[model samples]
Target: MNKTILSLTGAVLFATGAVVAQTMAQSTSESTVAPQEADAASVARGAKAWTNHCSRCHNLRSPSELNAELWDVSVQHMRVRANLPGAVADDIKAFLMSSATSTGVQYSTPGQGGASVASFAHLSPGDPLHGKEIYSQTCIACHGADGKGTISGVPDLTAAKGRLTKTDEVVLTNIIKGYQSEGSLMAMPPMGGNPDLTEQDIADVLAYLRKEYDIAPGTE
Candidate 1:
């Protein structure tokens, strides 16, 4: 009888081990497959949604033009502008925010160029809200939502060190006239090709960048 009991115990242990191993393998497979499936679905949905809802009124712009906060406002406002339902609009915003290369959070430091908001006098009193609108229409695709560029060679504004040193005048001038970096085939097209943006619109965007990026105010 004792031998019989021992044999039963051994069999139970073996069965338990097999079950655990099977579970582990299944778990591993799921972990790997789920993300890829979800990502694929998201991409398909984003592409379809963008084409149907976003392409008509606007062009595909860089995401870096505005930070996340600005993008949030811009997205909300654009819902109305695009005549999308609230739920659909929210989904589009989520997709864009998720898929776009911009950091969803605003940064507190200057980007690579060593420029900061302190240098700009005009940006001191600029309105981030208005700037958000301008950036959404113009800068969101390439620059991303966090002022970080998505393209490999494109400069990341959040990482710029030179931006910390720029004056408001310089920032304003760049926005108005556009810039062309060496070896860059694409210049920052004038107001990102939107001739409709007013000078005040540009100023508002500068202000938003200063405030979000934590640029110090210049002493008068």
Candidate 2:
């Protein structure tokens, strides 16, 4: 009887240990996946809000232009003017802060104005196929499916003396730092309002724009 009791106790303890270990493993997996999913969702929502509301006022500032703390303060101040809901503003803040620190791109201060031609020399030639994908996802909203301007102030990519008439360096820098066209009410936001865009992505998009729109160097 004594032996049976001891055996029963040992089995129960072993079972409990197995159960606890499994629970911990499950928790670990969930904790890892949940934050990644939540962060992506938050970034996406913030990108949408930024493109829709913030672009209405002026150019979209580059994430590299500000520190996280400054972004927080700026967003809070703009929240009132943009009439963004508290939750939406928070999401936008999350996106800005995340992008500001996350991208490995070298940052220049806003006071410096913009990037120089030599600064972008390391950029690889763009791949049109991949550029098409980026254009579809992000640029399509304002640039339209046909490379024409969807919004009133957006320059037509197909026009002879339009946006792409400039050299690749000029276009790339403008895209990275953001640009407001002369006499236009709205400005193109930095990184095309998508913080996830990389230098390669911008290159690809430029290649696609040239190919699809038949862009040629126009007389300055």
Q: Evaluated with lDDT, which candidate comes out highest?
A: 2
Compare the candidates by TM-score and give the number of the best one. 2
**Where does model 1 exceed 4 Å of error?**
1-124, 217-220
TM-score of each: 0.42, 0.54
Each candidate's lDDT (Cα)?
0.57, 0.72
RMSD, every candidate, angstroms? 16.6, 13.2
Q: Candidate 2: where are CA atoms >4 Å away?
A: 1-115, 217-220
Worst 10 contiguous positions by lDDT, candidate 2: 102-111
Residue-pair clashes per prediction, in order, are 40, 0
**Residue by residue across 1-220, what tens digits does model 2's lDDT show?**
9999999999999999999989899886877575433254566567566657777888766555687789888999999988889778877776677656534242342223544543567778889999998887767767778878665677788888877887777778777767665466655666775667798899999999999888954332
Instruction: Name the lDDT of candidate 2.
Output: 0.72
lDDT of 1 by residue, 101-203 (tens): 3322223222335333223443346789988876665555556678776444456667546442466665565555555455554345444434456677888
